[model samples]
Target: MASTDTNDIYWRAYFKAIKLQAGGGATEPGMGKEYFYIASNANRSIAASRFIPMATTNEYLYQEADNLMDPNAPLYVPGAGNTSYVQALYTYLRHVKRPRDTLTPEEEKAEKALTQKLKDAQATYRSERKSAMADWKEEKDFENLSFGAWAFKNARTFYAAWEALNTADGALQDFLASVYGADAQKYRSDMKKISGVANDILAPVPGLSMTCSNIPVLDVAEGIEKAKKGDRGPPVGEPVGYERPAYSLDPQYRDTMDRWAVEYDSTPSTGNAKVTWEQGSKTSWKEFGFENIEAGGGVTLFGFLRIGGHGGSHTEYENVKIDEKNSTVDIELKWKKLQFFNVYPGTWNIPQIRETYPEVVDLDEAQKLLIRPTQFLCASGLSITCKLGGQAKEEADRLYKKQVEAGGSAGVRWGLFGFDAGGGYKKEDGTQTSTSSYDTQKGELTISPTPTFGNCTLLGVRGQAVSI
Candidate 1:
């Protein structure tokens, strides 16, 4: 043996190196002593055992086994690869027994039904979602449309005038342009364009008309006049014309044609009867005349009294009769008192008299009365620091106090609990009284209380007064 130990040692070292390269643990089967024994017994070279050379003859199983033992072979597996091999075998067998394309009629029908159900569910979801979104949009659109309709209805007259101006061609157009200036023409053009755009936007919505025909339009002439006069502003603070039946007393005594008067027997009587009509601080008093006059005859004195500070005047008619035998003179006078009140414009819809009362009534009246102008009043010992405006302030204070004591509104009472001409509650009789009226000329609502015999008192009478 020529150095056989060295050869054996060299082969063992080569095998150990191969095992380490193959990631094999020391206890695992990698290039073991059994491989060396087999190779030596079969008269195979050590290199052939390590490389696992392919079979030259037609031994397919031998070639496959040799390839499996080769570490360098593409499909070669270590001991850990057995699990993957078993899994492949099971997969092949399963595929051979049942193909992927094979399906029974019942299974095909079930799959088709499931696909249809899924499509139907998807379609229903889309439709319901779309409908819900549409409903939301439609509700918002309805509110907008309602507002637009109200606006158009209220301003129909102005819109009509604008339309007419836009369509004008002849002398009328030139005249309008001259009177209203170039700005008016531009305004007309802009308004038409805006109206067109609004119509286009509302076209898709059903039940909305392109032309707001249902809205009431004012007269073109009236609209033009209002625009020219700059009366298109808000109606608040505008002066209103109001008229009511004011009470007047006859200068006659009870059950006699003789005029009623205060008689004074002597030139300076103990108590001289004085009749005074106060307008603010100004007062017109007539003392009992001691002049001698023929019996059954009277002297008529006519005069116009100015209501100071307030605007308006009233005519006073006085008749005086003197009886020389009795040393007496009788005086009678006729005068009017005006009551002032603030009013608000709105549809006064009285529920109590709506059903029973007739004549298509709509009273535009005051919301509330400003009873106390100043909440505080200053006073000094035995005298007052404030100089009041005579009978006007006095009557106003009296009315306010009365209303406060009665737990009602100040000034004049209105509504169901209000008193009518017969001194009865308006609700008692189905007849409606004109508690408030609208002033067409001034575009304001006014409250004018009809003066009765017992309620008439002279004071600072403001507003336009027509003598009755």
Candidate 2:
């Protein structure tokens, strides 16, 4: 990470450069973007805030187990931009000349065929990647059991199998970095720390790892209705979730545990009994950006307005539960709340702020407004469940529609989480800070707090299994 001042300068230049350009591709090559990108990929921004275009590659298709297991040579290393990254960029740049280069008829025809092959390759690669990943996860853990003693014990076996798939062909590692996005390296670090490098004799044993609620739309909707009438569970599956077993298996209760370490009617639960956030959690204002705010346009007033705040945010969790039958943990979180006041747009100038908030007489008031909060409880829960698009989401939509009549989601826009699947907006004041983002397509939920939100506490409930 760059020093604070450097980071600020870096971000300023990066944002300014993007604004100067029309986006999708850079136009202002002199704006230091090239310098920032070349400083090493580690310094690059994330997809949500990234001004630099990332290279796409097919190298993951040919990676070896050594590279797959080695943190230094993994298929995707955002920080390093690794080897595959360079290959992808070079491929694009090399092929880019095809458009401008004059060619004979035979060469043009050959080029067309090659272009078609690459296009077909893209589709084939994507399809193959999706199927392979799905099969791998299923084979590895059909149940998707939460990490605990089972994971701790089998951690090495899991890694061994995964790495083994990376053979001379390297198809197993294809787009592996895409799986965790920016967290690829962080995950690699943790896994290496956990079980050591897969095949390394020096690798140490992993010690071991969500109790979050994920409801299928129909089940959750039915549950809600049943709750209203007292006819819950069954016919519509009980709301099942795993939690830290009510009573952790203590050494004193060693005899109670099954010697086989298998789940049964009386499987001894180990570790903590509950998960909590005793005091409410809050986050300071982290800013956001707009999507090509001007799309294909450039250097407008919106360009000057880069960093925007979504105000501050806070969350309170009222309950956490688990169900043995379902083999799942259910975390019922109260809606997260947003807090802020002088939350005027971050890039807004004096005239803009004065016009927006007439009470502000001068720069001091405007500055004060940025830090202070006149309203503690602002917009309701930040739509944790609804935005993920499931039973919870459908239920929310129906609820929202009941408020606006029966036309359906038509003319209805989803203004929750990061707009348009993770972010297309800028970090200006007045925008809501991105709290919980769910990738419905990937069935992944990522909880990230803003850098500025110091009091922000993350919400989660989990347990570990230890030798009783």
TM-score of each: 0.14, 0.21
lDDT of each residue in 151-244, candidate 2, tens digit only: 3344544433434433311221222222334445533343232122221111212221002113212222333234335453443222222221
Ten-residue region with minimum lDDT total, candidate 2: 49-58
Please report how far candidate 1 places residue 134 from its true position, in Å. 31
| Candidate whose lDDT is highest | 2
Best by TM-score: 2
* Steric clashes per prediction: 1, 27
Give the runs in model 1 whose Cα sits over 4 Å from its true position: 1-148, 151-162, 165-420, 428-468
